[model samples]
Target: MKKHNWSIVLLFLLFVSLSISCKKKQPVDADPPEGTESNLVSAEVTGSYNSNQLRLLALAAEYDAAVPFIKYDVSFIKINYKTTYKGNEIVASGMLVVPKNMPTAPSMISAQHGTTFLAAAAPSNVPQFAAFTGYELLSSAGFITAIPDFIGYGASKNVIHPYYDEYHSAIAVRDMLTAVTAYLKKEKTAFTERLFMIGYSEGGYVTIAAQKTIETSPIPGLSLKAVAAGAGGYDVTSIVSAIIDNGTYSDPAYVAFILNSYNITYGWNRPLTDFFREPYAGRIPVLLDGTNHASAISDQLIADPTALLNPVFYANMQNSNGELALKAAFATNSLLDFVPATATRLYHGTADETVFFQNSQLTFDKYKASGASKLELVPVPGGTHESTVLPMMLNALPWFQSLDK
Candidate 1:
């Protein structure tokens, strides 16, 4: 996974255009909208930025003089909505961005964010650094952007984040879009009703998972237009298998996060020692408690699977017949079986070490062979896991804009 801070800087620059004034734009707080309906619990305008401000920021950040032109002022709203988790209904939170004063109804994009270890980095919680998030920049491009905090952040912070669990991740997004639609309608805001999805890293996984959910189980009045996912681990089983086989992987925190998340999310309750070595096992729970940064956790843990994992557990993970329950969990969460039903672009840095590039390769090949004609695999030449995100957006945004037209 890309370091959280790097992703923030890169994504913010990619979307917001860079500027020194990128410092926190004080939110223009508004009274919470009245008459909340359906799954929408509450909505409040947190901040607003004009086109000129974005343009200046863009000019400051642009490598060349050319930057994405700002067209509309954007407003960010922090919304609390009802969604399901572990089969129980719970309230979730996300950042909602709307274009102000558009002549025509703007389309919607549910932008899922990459893996973030700090609770403060959750979309709804980052108003102080909202410009850096990049989702708001999509709003300036005239799309209503819905960015979920997923569970385990914002309103549902008490719950352990489901991480790559398909159902939870997908449902958080799907339900947020639903709640946003209802809220917009209630507020008498005009929107196109057309929808798109995009994300990178864990966000990418959530994007695809949400697409599968939206496609397989129809959302009323919300047809998915298209999606672009970059460097996502769509093939969980294959990813884990490769990690064990290779015996070395970068970003031990990511691997640990998945293991710890699955243990809690699935009710496995496996001891950390079952997954990691001595001091590391004891250190992991504290690291993942929604506090430490990803790099901090990684610094504390070794990257060698043999050194990090228990010998028996490591051996079992590799054996086809071993770790059946864990394997089943991975297979259950993997996206390999589902071919996308709508236009889908899977982007990967050819050099991504965090989530192996093969995951996308295998997924694309499977989708193509399974007759997904609209599917496309975009390999970013020499792009590492972190470097691929910007190019993916540069390529994807135009494709999405063309479709929107």
Candidate 2:
């Protein structure tokens, strides 16, 4: 009897151990997670604007109320659209706020959000730079303001928000613009015929992509008059190279974000073991969640890939011969390969930590060479990336206003 009891106990322990091990081995859900679309698809206009227009106006109001900013009569609209890349049904949502009692406003501004938050999420949160820029102020100032949630944030479908890829970002922008314009034209709400684009940080990069796409694609109802991009990641390769060469503290985490984005978008052509070893490989999923806390922690934990990880992983990443294919894949120019020669207002702080001011200069020079006559590169003196909005806007608003003529 005693022997039989001991055998049963041992078997139970073995079973429990196997279960624990299996749990540990389970893959993390790092890819884009799923989310439900908001029920507020369209709004009802009680006054002058029709139902669709009123809905956009209501959304803008909600957005204004959500954040502590000057209130504008804003409306919210949600769009359900499909993209080919992930076969995922995406939602392009944003706020459309027109000036009170304005008729035939000459211009529209599409405000793009920065790197840390989704465009739709920005207006609701105070910490987000987009909210501070007074987009509401812009609307009250008689500009038709349109803010998109990009591809992943808010109602946008899919999980992997493509980093600096202009194609996907531009598509989202174009679609949102189309929806808003259609709503306006259908309702006969007279507003700006000329369009303007504005973005900061990741948003700045997105604006560049959208401008390029509008110039290249045959998308209708897009009358881009002026574009303002500030502190944008114009050149991914150059930015990464600068981080590596300068030994900036944030390089590793930035690299980690890029690697995770690329790896998930274009999964490993080679074995995963060839690139990342042990802990770093395991942490990939955690780092790519697009959360503030995760980004901050990653910045501290990862300084240099070669120094932090094991020799095998470091060698694989640094090895020209071994990583030749992977390097080549990564070496492809994600930005600046397709910039439009549209009238542009570029802003950068001399002391930007994430995206160097030099990148902005290089982009300006390239745009000039590309026969872009209406380009203005404005450098904010003694300004860092974080504190650039007010000064950049002061420079941009006048220029944007001039485009109306």
Which model scores highest in lDDT?
1
Put down candidate 2 lDDT per residue, 1-405, tens digits, no spaces: 012454445434533443343222222122221352222233222111223332332233333232322333433333333342445455545555566555555468988877643333444222222233345356655577777666666545346666666567787777767666665665566775688888888889888888887878734555778889898968766675566556444535556556556666565634444455556666655555545443464654566655555567555555556555445644554565654667788899998877899989887887778677888889988778777865666567777777776
Q: Which stretches of candidate 1 lie over 4 Å from their true place?
A: 1-37, 55-66
The sequence of per-residue lDDT tens digits that candidate 1 reaches over residues 1-405 is 234565457546544442333344433322334653467777777666688765655444431122463589987788888899999999999999899998889999999999989888788864444324555567887788899999999899999999899999999998898888877877778888578999999999999999998998877767788999988999998888888678578788988999999999999998999988898999887898887878898999998989999888898987878889988999999998787989999999999988989999999999999999999999999999877777887787778889996
Q: How far is candidate 1 from the true structure (C-alpha RMSD, Å)?
A: 4.3
Give candidates' CA RMSD values in order: 4.3, 15.0
In candidate 2 the C-alpha lDDT for residue 19 amounts to 33
Candidate 2 lDDT at 382 equals 76
10 residues in a row with least lDDT, candidate 2: 24-33
Q: Pick the candidate with the highest TM-score.
A: 1
